[model samples]
Target: MTAHAAGRYATALFELAKSSGAADAVEADLSAFRAMLDSSPELAGALASPLHAAEDKVSVLKALAEKAKFNELTLNTFGVAARNGRAGDLGKVASVYAALAAADRGVVTADVQTAAPLTKKQTEALAASLKGAFGREIEVRTDVRPELMGGLIVKVGSRMFDSSLRTKLDGMKTAMKEA
Candidate 1:
């Protein structure tokens, strides 16, 4: 249900951005917003907290958007989301918007999670490999997950490839118990 709402918000935003020739800018703004959410638990909590009124959320988001100098379309979309009480799902909406933007350019999005941050060359190599394997342009979204300990996880559409060390250790533990 939350996914559905996020999709609706993202679709509407994408259409508006597309019509205004600002899809890329909006996507960038949303991506920056998502990064902020990731970095600031207080901000994320404030947006997600039901204790706050919708109008208040709108005001806060609007202030942040203005300070960030986001595109007008992006700011308006955030205001709409906050007004609709979907501020908590803004991160998901941003992700969906990015996918929409990538699809518009005939590209596929690959969500990559690693135990540590990948270097620019490593990211490029991974993108090249994914493109070769999928026979399509690949847009890589990388996230760091130290709990993985090692290796990486990649998700492209409904398909997921998990090679993380944590999963491997768990698999081995299960096998040993069975044996």
Candidate 2:
């Protein structure tokens, strides 16, 4: 599906899940759906294929939902998406719904890329700083990227704070060259 269509589906699903008070459960189901997509290329291909008949797709989705033991709300959402011929956008929808729910709960997710593993205290301090800056609870996800050389990159929503040594050197090099 096109990115635009996927975003629309995600927004709609987010709204519905929020209203039903099943946001967390739906997010879990979506996480499972993403894992399934990753593990089964055939399933992903089928879902994204526009040539498939709606009924056939719906039946396959229902079977998968049952096998995965998804809650009623999640199953119904999938059914609705299938019937509407928007099954291709389910993955993106699931992602967007999770983000929306997190935001609604005053939680900000930070993607932290660091040169090395951070100690527990460092992680706690980072989370606290982020919480103070964003005025909300912060959930930090850390990834070790040796390319960073030293320091970390923090991303929350559309804003990013890049303090990695590699980035700093690159900026300085660019400035020197320009001068």
Candidate 3:
């Protein structure tokens, strides 16, 4: 249900942004806003908290928009979400909006996890390699997972390429036991 609501909200926002020629900017704003929410539990809690009045949540979003210098469309979209009591699902909306934006631009996002953070050059190189393989432009979002021990994992939609050392070790252990 929440996912449905988020999709509706994101689709509406995406349409508005596309028509307004601000799709990219609005998407960036939403991504930034989503990242902010992810990094700030207190802020997310306040916005999603029933203890905070609806209007109060709206005001908080307005103020945060100002502080963050969010684009007009982005700010208004936040207001709409707050008014519709969908603030709690803003992150989900942002994610959906991102997917929509990427699709519109004919780009695909790859969730990449590595044992350590990649340098900008390395990121670009990997994206280039993936683009060549997938035959589509790739936007790589990266995560550092020390537990991976080494190597990387790439996930694009339902497809995944796992080269992580942890998985390799597990496979070897399984093979040994079978032997």
Please report the candidate that would top TM-score against the real structure: 1
Candidate 1: tens digits of C-alpha lDDT, residues 1-179: 99999999999999999998998889989999999999998999999999999999999999999999999988988888899889999999999999999999999999999999999999999999999999999999999999999999999999999999999999999999999
Candidate 2 runs further than 4 Å off: 111-129, 132-135, 140-154, 161-179
> What's model 2's lDDT at 146?
96
Give the per-residue lDDT of model 3 (tens digit) for 45-102. 8878778777888898999889989889889878888887888889889888998899
Error (Å) of candidate 1 at residue 81 is 1.4
Clash number for candidate 1: 0
For each of the candidates, the C-alpha root-mean-square deviation to the true structure, in angstroms, is: 1.1, 4.3, 2.9
Candidate 2 global TM-score: 0.66
| lDDT per residue as tens, model 2, 1-179 | 46677677777777777788877888889989988986787998898798899888899999999999997888887888888888877877776766777778778888799999999999999999998898889988677899999989998999999999999999999999999
TM-score of each: 0.95, 0.66, 0.80
Which ranking of candidates, highest lDDT first? 1, 3, 2
lDDT winner among the candidates? 1
Measured on C-alpha atoms, candidate 2 has an lDDT of: 0.85
Candidate 1 wrongly placed segments (more than 4 Å): none
Task: Give per-residue lDDT, candidate 3, residue 53.
Answer: 77
| Model with the higher lDDT, candidate 1 or 3 | 1
